[model samples]
Target chain A: MLTLAGVGKRYRRRSVLAALDLALARGEIVGLLGPNGSGKTTTLRIAAGYAWPDSGEVRLAGEVFDPDQATLRARIGYLPERVPLYDPFTVGEYLDFVAAARGLHGPSRASAVARVIAAFELDAVRTRVIGRLSKGFRQRIGLAQALVGEPDVLLLDEPTNGLDPFQILEARRMIRAAARGRGVIFSTHILQEVAALCTRVVYLHEGRLVELAVDGRDAGLEVRLARASLDAVRARVHALDPAIELRSAEALGEDRHRLVFDLGRAGVARAELVRLLAEFADLESVGEATPDIEQALNAALAAQARGAAA
Target chain B: MRGFVTLFARELRHYFVTPIACVVIAVFWAASGFFFSFNALFVAAPDMVSAFHNMSLLLMLMMPLVTMRTLAEERSGDTLELLLTLPVGEAAIVAAKYLALLVILVLMLAGSTLAVIPLALYGTPDYGPILGGYLGVFLLGAAFAAVGLAASSCAANQVVAAVLTWALLLLMWFVDYAAALDGAGGAVRWLQHVSFSVQYLDLIRGVLTRGAVVWFGSVIAVGMVVATQVLRARRA
Candidate 1:
């Protein structure tokens, strides 16, 4: 539903987005993971038509976005990094105003406002002015404004920035629910949120697209074993087959070690590695390493840095 | 048109909910009324013409306070993003704010009309000049509001908006004063004729010429157009 081709943005003398390419299909919830000053917000702003890219183009549903063409704005909903709200307006009134601004009129406007209020679960403080609401409520109201128009594409910058645990879960559920028929591109630094809410992850480092990975179930488990030594166990495993390359062997405690190996390339199987280790030392446990999104992100960033240095 | 109406209503409702609009009107009306009563009742003047002149000055000060928050507050609060992202033209947003300020000016003019009641009751006042005076006040208020809105568009905060607007209004008023000085003739005189307050004074003396109306209308039109351009360029 959204396409960005060779997009770039520069501020002052520094580049924020560098020839970035991104695509979002319908009903896909893509999380943009990046640290500060990584151009995540800049990319989202360019997509929302709030900030124009220095080069290249952004297409929404096959239509090129000319900043002069105001009609295209209706097809996209954006929640800025800092939720800008009129504090004097009540939650209901704010939604009503947003509905009307989106060109919904009469009964349709009323119903749109009502639907968003209910969908975001804002009934409790609907009558209260937004300035008086808690941060969680304010964040919900910001998201509520974006959802008021039911746009085809939603660009949210740090949607769960300042929420409590419960609020974060509620926001995750709401975002997942909205992704049923719409394309969502949410930028966040929270790796856990990406694992929990996003179908795919887009990693950004220093204004460049690093990697895009599909989020999947944890296929590996992690176990800390107490044994004679990781080197002693690894030697026994290597004795089974000289082709096995030990990834890492680190001492945990007194005579305890954490061992990691590349099981895929090894000629021997997991059963063989376990049997050889058991023969050498007392086996504490045998398991797989769990998938870690943070580890993946760090690796991607580290590789990008290395590439830049090279 | 729907978007414009919606934004305009929301701005008007915002004023009613907050104390900014009310405080401006109250302070303006009270201050102007006191000056008028002191000049007319205490000084034993039988006419309210001078009182209208003083009220015009009051508008030069108060109109900025009324319009300072129109766009500057939105920009600072970050709500301008929400407004700009809506499927509405920039002209619609500018026109809506201009209309909202005009409505507030009308209501303020209505409140200031109370000063005319005593003149009508106790003294034999000419209704023609009184009517002309109110019309002049409305036009001057509109022009001031427009200038204030333009300043608000450029400023990032309400305080800066108010200060910039007041400076622009003061320049207009000072232009009229400087035009009347000796030795600066011809072109300067013509420039002074374009002074917003000077043209407004011409209408206050029961002289409602089409030229004066056109001048004020043109000022408002240009101010709003510039404001719209600023908004569009920033987003771009």
Candidate 2:
């Protein structure tokens, strides 16, 4: 199991991640969903041991994940957002070096490199320099590099970013196959990919982790299935946070009033808004906040994270 | 460690598989040969002291180009991210790269060292100064390569890396001459002690002093340590 307890990170006065708590066990595929500048990359960077969190800690199998310890670091295979690879190196040569650096030696190193090459279907272009390969082949080569040592955990950042539809399907399949016995945390904007691949999801808004209900609940959507006071709920929301104004209240009769939150103008924390919604007991079945709204809310969230950091 | 050795071997392959290492070596040998032949033919004594000075000066300028891409290219290409994520210390990465460039420098100098055989063949050249001069040249190359590696890490691309490295090496080489303008005995001695060219003068004189060897070795160590720090800081 891998765990991040109260992990936080800041870039100058801007907090990129704040008080994140999460865990991953083997055979679980978790999707990290976030808008741009929401600290998804920072979270992955900290998790990958490439950067240290400003606060809290990460544990790998009950031990603190020390960056100084090669054995601990060897247990992780990371594919950064940029597809970090030497363009001039052949796929075979690159994987060979990755395997050796991951602590696989001699015959084991050769076998490990071979295993990933075959698994990622890189054998055909193993001799080809990465600079000359197509985007799909390059992406596959990046995957092969990460899978070389058969690590216990995988951290992938937008694995299917620039791939064609066919290549995207191939990459999705590869992620499924690769996560068979290892814990996988992948970040992607494609909700369909999350629905298709992730067993659970974590959302980041302005570098803060939004702890959505883990009992099969999405962060941004719910349908009204109960009768409760709409006016009382509106009063409570305003009282809890003055700037918040309930956008619309529709009467469903028999003491039921459907409340639709205008979160875009509210600039309220998701947790606070969810808490206000929970009080009504009439609201239920809300879908995700929606990625389309991601841009409109980016500034608000960024301002919020920066204000909190300050 | 396996990580260090792996990185080192990879860098060496990068040097040879491309035309980079061959071009650098050819140009280096041509330049050194031109300077040596000119000095040997034109000088009254036909000794290699001036030739060695010319070669060291040539190497001072060329070594950064040899090392400029070592780290800067990795950063620009996004490979540094992959390397840092590996289960290896920053020091290992720095050491492996610096050693690889230094080894290439030493190997290139071996070709120049062979020029001494011809110098000995044509005239009554003292073999002691030639041996000391070669040793000095090797040390000088390694030191400059280290400086270049440090500069590469600080740069965003290879051109900036090469320019920064040149600026740094030139400063170290000329600081003693700059100090001479001060005309104070104690300051002059101290500046000479710190100057790379002044340190090289001992070997050029066939003195082979321990202090100069230690000074060059320290420069290599300090330069590499600075490079390692730069690499580690980038992770944040």
Candidate 3:
């Protein structure tokens, strides 16, 4: 697990991260969602101990991160946004060097190199120099290097950048596999990646933690009873819970109606509503609605804008 | 320490895999050999010591070109981030790079030993002065490599690294020249004391002065320390 408290970084006069606080649990894939220059890379760099923050502390697995501490460094695997790699070295050679640098020696180092090569499906290009490989292969090699030591934490910056659709899916599968036992924190501008790959999402804007949301917790469905018309169903739902705001209502067919409700923190249970509706007419089937991450992200941004104006 | 050796091996491998190291050693060998042969055969010199002296100047110029890519190329290629993020310390990274350049210097200096073969075949070659001259050349190359590495650390581009290293070496070469000028004694004395060629010249003449040895060693140490600081500060 990783925790950041009161973390702030300033370059010259510009503040990159402003008192941002976040905690990622073990086996949880937390996606850092933000636009460009939202301090995503800076946060990851600070967490990886590659860059010293101006203020605040980072704790990984109960130990405070010290820039001079090599033991803590060995517990972290970081894939920078640029994926710095030596072009002339073969894929196996690069991984071997990284493994050695991480202090794995002899047979253990060789075994780690072989394991990551197989895990990333890089056996075909094991002997090929990284410079000759395609962009997708190079990215895979980068990921392979990061995973070589089997660190306790993985910090990846835009791991899916510059990949094709198939490669992206493959990378997602690999990331999910890596997150099975370790704490994984990845940053990206893509919203859908959070829904597909991350269990928790942290939104950053202008160097601050804007919002944190559980991926599937904020969605609910509204069902219209067959005994009532669309308007009647809306009115009945409104009567049951005065706080339920009707978003839209329409008649599907004879005696069947569809109604959408925006529950604003009134905490109305679907079963209770269905049971209450059964008194007036026969209750229809109920299903939960899924809210898009993009919509939630936009709403968060809009709320931040309004708060800034206020 | 193991990390340092691994990094050193990787850097050395990089040098060998690319043509940069080969081209530098080959060109230096060809030029030094030609000059030594011409002075010995055509001019009928009694010894190869003078040839050794002239070869030192060539090393002052060529060592920078060989070492300019050590850190500068890593910066330009964006590989420094990868290196710094590893569990290795800053001193290990600096020492590894320094050792890699030292290996190349040893190979090139060893190549110049072939010039001694002809001298022993025909003329009476003094093994003492030859040994002393080699020690001096090795120290001079080490110092040059350190200075070049420092320049490379400060430079963002390879061309600028090479040029800045050349300028630094040239200044050291002319330190003695400026020391003889009027009213420039203070600045000149400091420069002369740190001059790579001046310290090296004493060793070439078969004189193993402690002051000269310490001077060259200090140059290497100070240069490496500054380079390490630069890397650390940049990461910070």
- Number of the top lDDT candidate: 3
Q: Is the docking of candidate 2 incorrect, acceptable, medium or high quality?
A: medium
Q: What's model 1's overall lDDT?
A: 0.81
What are the per-model numbers of colliding residue pairs? 1, 10, 0
Candidate 1 C-alpha lDDT tens digits along A1-310: 8999999889989999889999999988889988898899889988998888889899999999877767788889899999979998899999988888888889999998999889989999999989999998899899988988789999999999988999999999988887779999999988899988887788877677865433434223233456576666667767778666543323234435565444544556677777666777776767775335765564455456646878
The deviation in Å at residue A169 for candidate 3 is 1.4
Top candidate on DockQ is 3
lDDT of 3 at A120: 90
After superposition on all C-alphas, the RMSD of every candidate to the true structure, in Å, is 4.8, 6.2, 4.1
lDDT string for model 2 (A47-116, tens) is 8888888899999889898667656888888999989877788988989989988988999999999999
Predicted complex 1: CAPRI docking category: medium
Measured with C-alpha atoms, the lDDT of residue A249 in candidate 1 is 29
For each candidate, what's the DockQ?
Answer: 0.64, 0.64, 0.69
